[model samples]
Every structure is written in structure tokens, then in C-alpha cells.
Target: MPELPEGKVTQGIAIATAAAFFLLWIAGWLDVASLKGGFIPARVSGLVQVPGAVPVWLTPLSATLVHAGLLHIGFNLLMFVFVGRFVESVIGGGASLILYIVGAYAAALLHWSMDPTSTVPMVGASGAISATFGAYALFFGRDRTRGIGPLSGYAVRVLWLASAWIFVQALIGMAALGGVQVAIFAHIGGFVAGLALARPLLLWRYRKA
Candidate 1:
């Protein structure tokens, strides 16, 4: 495994990334007309019916870095600040970056699979963050998990919590019920990638020790 960079370095990079995204979002919002290139090409173009051809502008690789609007950016950044710190602290900097990219790509792949004709270019770090959430649940737990609710004395194993969450997401994703289009699949993809990637590193460390 690569020698991952320590805390501050990775944190700084993450902060800078968030900042750039914010600036881009602001610029796009201020100029509304420029929104064409901003990230909503799929929404703008009726080309959503295209087969397998992702707009060059909205490639899965670049989608994570883009955002739909200020609200979108704000929500994603907040989650990043909250979950990213602990995740980075536990996993090394390099690994965290890898998780972000892998999660984002995995989420996009899943989305593409579901909506092959959707020229609707998906954007935002939600997919990556969702992956982080998955990894966190695996490394940590649901009850001890803060922010969702009052952190009293909730302690559920990672696997159990993760399974339950997945079930909930499935129920919500069903749409026939009341769940909205929240990209639950992206979260799942990111999570699976995190578990798959993080497991080996964790196991290796245990063996080394």
C-alpha cells in the first residue's frame, strides 16, 4: 500500500477542494446564462435519451466535482466537514482520497446503469460522501453515530447497522412508496467500495501489529 499522507495535508486538500467548488457554484449562479457549462447539460439537453454516451462535459469522472446549485453545494460540503474529518483521521489521507474518487465513480456507474439513457449528468460529492457514510458505519456504528439523532447510548455493530440502513434506503428508493430520487444507489456503491477497499488495509495493519 502507498504511504498515505498524514492529517493536515489531506485536510487542507479537502478544504481547498470544497472552496473551489463553492467559488464555481457562485460564479455559475451569478451568471445564470453561464449555467449551460456549469453542470446541468443533461437537464438542459433533451439528450437524456442517448444510449451510453455521457456528455463530454458531464463525464462520471468530473460529475462529483460539479454541483447543481448553491443549496446542493452547501448540503454536500456540510456533510463532508462532518464525516470527512473522522474518516480521514481513521483511514490515511491517501486512502480517504481514494475512497472519495472510487465512491464517486462507483455511484456514477450505478446511476448510469439504472439510467443508461439519462443524459441527465449527475453531479456533487454526495456519492463520495455516501461512500464515506457507509465506511463510517462499518468502522463505527449507527447509535454511537452522532448528528442523525441524540447520541444517547446507541451501539450497533457496523454490519447490522449498514444492513438496516440499506433496507431503509431500498424502501425509500422504491418511489412507489414516498421516497424521492435521492441517489441511494450511489451511496450504496460508495459504501461497497469503501468496505472492499478499507477492509484490506485494516486487516494488513492488524496483521502487522
Candidate 2:
């Protein structure tokens, strides 16, 4: 067996979170935890109330740690292992964690705003991982993009990529929603948040250096 960024804090978080998810599933507690921890737009928007030890308001944040199923967690963790490792390596662990957390909240807020009265609970790390993708794009998009800084060149490419990603996500969400819940808005929100934060993180890293 080989190690994949084994010592990094951001990577550790992803592994630990995935482990916890698996453990919960093995213990038959995943469903119970998800119901209690998953973010529900109606509850978040005050359109409905849920009684629990953990406040409904906190579900948005808590929901990021839960996943709908094995495949869901697997895909999210794979992305986290690859993209998250890169983002964390570039921005440092603390900034990476901040981006993930902020992205989660942003995603939840957007999802709530879009479907304020819906009672469905949203769960998974896709939104947070999407944020990492956004950050990765901003950091590396310039190389792939032709031209220079802001407004033209790499910026245009980034914008196009982001738009295409969102569009695809929207389509997937529409197609999957009837069978399985897909928080498309959450992914968009998180990616936008990551894109927005990427520059600031870079600047901060530079200043620190």
C-alpha cells in the first residue's frame, strides 16, 4: 500500500471524514445521522422546523460531513484526495479548510434560497469538493488559458469552464433529482465561493511568504 499526501491536514480531514461515514454506515447509524444532520432547505429557511439536539441552523455545516451512499462518499473522497491535496498544498492546510467550510455554508445558503420550502435533506461533500475544483481552476486555469490577467486570456477560460461546469451540474441535477437527490445549487455556490476566494488566498499566501 502507498500513502497519498498522508501527512497533510486537509488530506487527513478527508480521510477521517470518509472513515467516519463508513463507520456510521457499518453501524447502521448513517441514515439516522443524515436525517438529523443533513441540511433541509425548508428548515434552514424557516419554512419548516425540525426538533433535534443539534440545531437546524447548523445542519448546513453538519451536512457536509455526511453522504447519501457508498458511491457518493467514494466519489467525493476521490476528488478530495486528488483536488483537495493540490489546493491544500498550494494554499496551505488552514486556507484549504477555510475554503471548504465557507464553501459548504455558501452552498447550503444557495440551495436554501433556491428551494426555500422544500423539505428534502441535502447531504455530501460534493459542494466542498466543488469549491476545491474552483480554487484549482483559478490557480492553474491561467496555464491552460491563453492570454494574460483578469478579463482576458486565462480569466475568460476560467469563466467558460465554470459556466460549463455549472450548466452540466444543472442538467445532472435535473435528471437525478427524481431518483436521487442532487444539490446542484450547492455545487455552484461552493465553486463560486472557491473562485471568489482563490485570489485572496493567493495574496495571503504571498504576504505570509
Candidate 3:
């Protein structure tokens, strides 16, 4: 493991996320929120527009705060709280938060790039949460890692983990409950960001030391 810094529990993202779910639920506007806040590629590309849709740039962030069902939000928040808190502890609050926000944007771009014309709204935080999961998978794994070709062991590990994760997400996307299609590509984009950024963020944490 990388040497630990004096870590603190920084869980504002997770807390605020849970709060968003609750607040939206109580207001009975989750469905309405989804229609307005969800990241719809067509809306962004100007191929289609909804009158109440939030700004294209902001949809990525807003999308993370809404979900399709109890299972959706529950699973997303569970992974986020678990993975994010650990990453935050080692890298501190700001960097971890950046990981999540960047994850959201990356996810949106990937989803948009893959299906630029789709009018379906992609909602939920699974994509954003995948970033923290990627970091966690990278930093605290077995040391038996070996590189293939020009790739470093760490890079290889990232690729392998990403492949496995993408596969799993593919399955989830296919077998999603109640026909709620999972955003596999979005998850991929965010996970890649986490894998790419985890070490840099770690180095950033102690750069002056």
C-alpha cells in the first residue's frame, strides 16, 4: 500500500447524494427530475430538445443526483460511500470530489459519443461512483502484477480491471431490472478516469513532502 497520509473522513459527497435522493423522493418529483435532469445525448447535440430539460453541461452533474428506483440509488450510494470515503481518506477531500465530478462528465461524454442521437435520458450515479471504485481497485490490490508489452504493471492492472468491470457492467446493462438500461459506457468512462487519476492524485497528496 502507498504510505498513508493523516487521513480524515470526508463524506460530504455521499451525504449530499443521499440527501438529494431523500429530498427528491419527499417532493415526489423524482420522475419529473429524471425527465429534466437526466443526461440526454440528443438534447446536448441539439438533435432534440425538451422545454424543461436542464442545461446540457449541467445535466451530467444533475443526472447523478437522480435515479430510477430504490435499488438503483441504494446500490449506487453503497458503492460510492464505500469506495469514495477510502479514496478521499488517502487523497483528501477535494481530489476525491474532483474524481467524482470528472467521472460524471466523462460518463456523459462517453454515453453521448456512443449514441449521439439517442433521446433516452441516462440517469443515476453508478457511472460517477465507478470512478472511486476504479481508484480503490487500483491502489490496494495484489503485488503479483506484471506488465505486458510496453505497459507498466500498474497500467496492465488498470486495463485488466477495466476489462473485467466493463464486462460486468455490460451484463448489468443487459439484465437490468424492470428494464432500466444500465449505462455501461458511462461506467467505463468514469472508471478509466479513476484508474488514470488515482496515482496522480496520490502523488499530488504528498507532492511537497
Candidate 4:
């Protein structure tokens, strides 16, 4: 495992993001912020008017910084600290940031495709964190397949793990939606983006090194 200090840029971003979410909640601006910053498929698709001054195109990025509640932010930040730090340590902060942003956009695009007319706002860092998990799995999953059947190679193992993860996410999404809506497609999109980007980033990192 890569050892990242507390003050690493990627870690700082994760902490700062969590702090921002808490601050918004404390200030009673979470609702307003979500309204303006959360990713809304209808807004992106131009089927609905944006409520605030922020541009619709920017919501996908901004939405990543917002969270629905304490549990949402807590889980995201925990994953960010654990998975993101390692990814950043391996690939460097720039690549980590790029992965996060790209993952968020990818998540938004997938969610929009799945439900373009939905009025509910989508907000969370799960997609970005899922991207980190994808990269992590690509880098470290082969050795960790303890119970799973033997795989042909690293790629196949990673695919198996990803498939299992997606299945779990689907189950979680169904349960979450039963109480409060969750964007399961966003998680899938982010994980896919991370999986797609990880090898290239690793190659680039190696070349640069």
C-alpha cells in the first residue's frame, strides 16, 4: 500500500470537500446549494430550467462536492481518504484530480442517459470515490482474490471484481431508492471511467518515472 501523508493534496481536497459539505449543512445552505449545484439530468438535457446563476454544464463537477446527508458524506470521505490517497500516491495528485473530475462527468452523463427527465437532484462524491476504487482494483486486486476462483490473468481478475462490485452497487441502489433515491448508474459510470483510465495513467506514470 502507498503511504500518503495527511497533508497530501489529494487528501486535503477530500478533507476540504467534507468540511465544505458540513459547513453547508451548518449554514443551512445545503438545500440551496444542492438546488444550484447538484447534477440534475433534466437541467443538463435542457428539459428544465436551472434554478440559480450557476451554469448547467458546471453542475456535474459541482455536484461532486455536495452530499445528501451525514452518512452520504461520511462514507464518501472515508473512501476518498483510503482509496484516493493510494491512487494519488501512485499516479500523483494531478492524475488523481483528473480521474475524479472525469469520473464525475462520466457519472453525470450516465445518470442523465438513464433518467433525463427526473427532477430529483443528484449529489455526492461516491462516483469520484468509485473511480479511485477502480484504479485501486486495477493496481492491487489480482493478489487479493482469496475466495474467488482462479483467474486467467490480471485483467480477468479485475473484471470479475468489478462485476461483483457493480452487482453489489445495484443491490444497494435498489435498497436506497426504496427509502431515498440514489444514482446507481453514476457509480457504474465512475467505476467504468476509472477502470478505463487506470492502465493508461499507470503507463503514463511509468513512462514519466
- Model 4 collision count: 0
Ranking by lDDT: 3, 4, 2, 1
Choose the strongest candidate by lDDT.
3
TM-score of each: 0.65, 0.87, 0.92, 0.88
- What is the lDDT for 96 in model 4? 85
Q: Candidate 4 on 1-209: residue-level lDDT in tens?
A: 44654528677778778888988999999888888889888887788886453698888888988888888888788778887877877787878888988988988888899989988889988887788889887876647543445545655666776797789898998788436577888998899899989988878878956
- Runs off by more than 4 Å, candidate 4: 1-7, 144-155
Q: lDDT of all the models against the reference?
A: 0.59, 0.80, 0.84, 0.81
Instruction: Report the backbone clash tally of model 3.
Output: 0
Of candidate 3, the 10-residue stretch with the lowest lDDT total is: 1-10
Off by over 4 Å in 2: 1-7, 142-150
What does the lDDT read for residue 80 in candidate 3? Answer: 75
Q: What tens-digit string does per-residue lDDT give for candidate 2 at 1-209?
A: 32445428667778777887888888988777777888888776677766662588677677877887878888788877887877877888888888888888888888888979988788988887788889987776545656655477756766777797799898988798437768888999999899889889877878956
lDDT of 4 at 67: 87
For all candidates, the clash counts are 1, 0, 0, 0
TM-score, ranked from best to worst: 3, 4, 2, 1
The 10-residue segment with the lowest total lDDT in model 1: 30-39
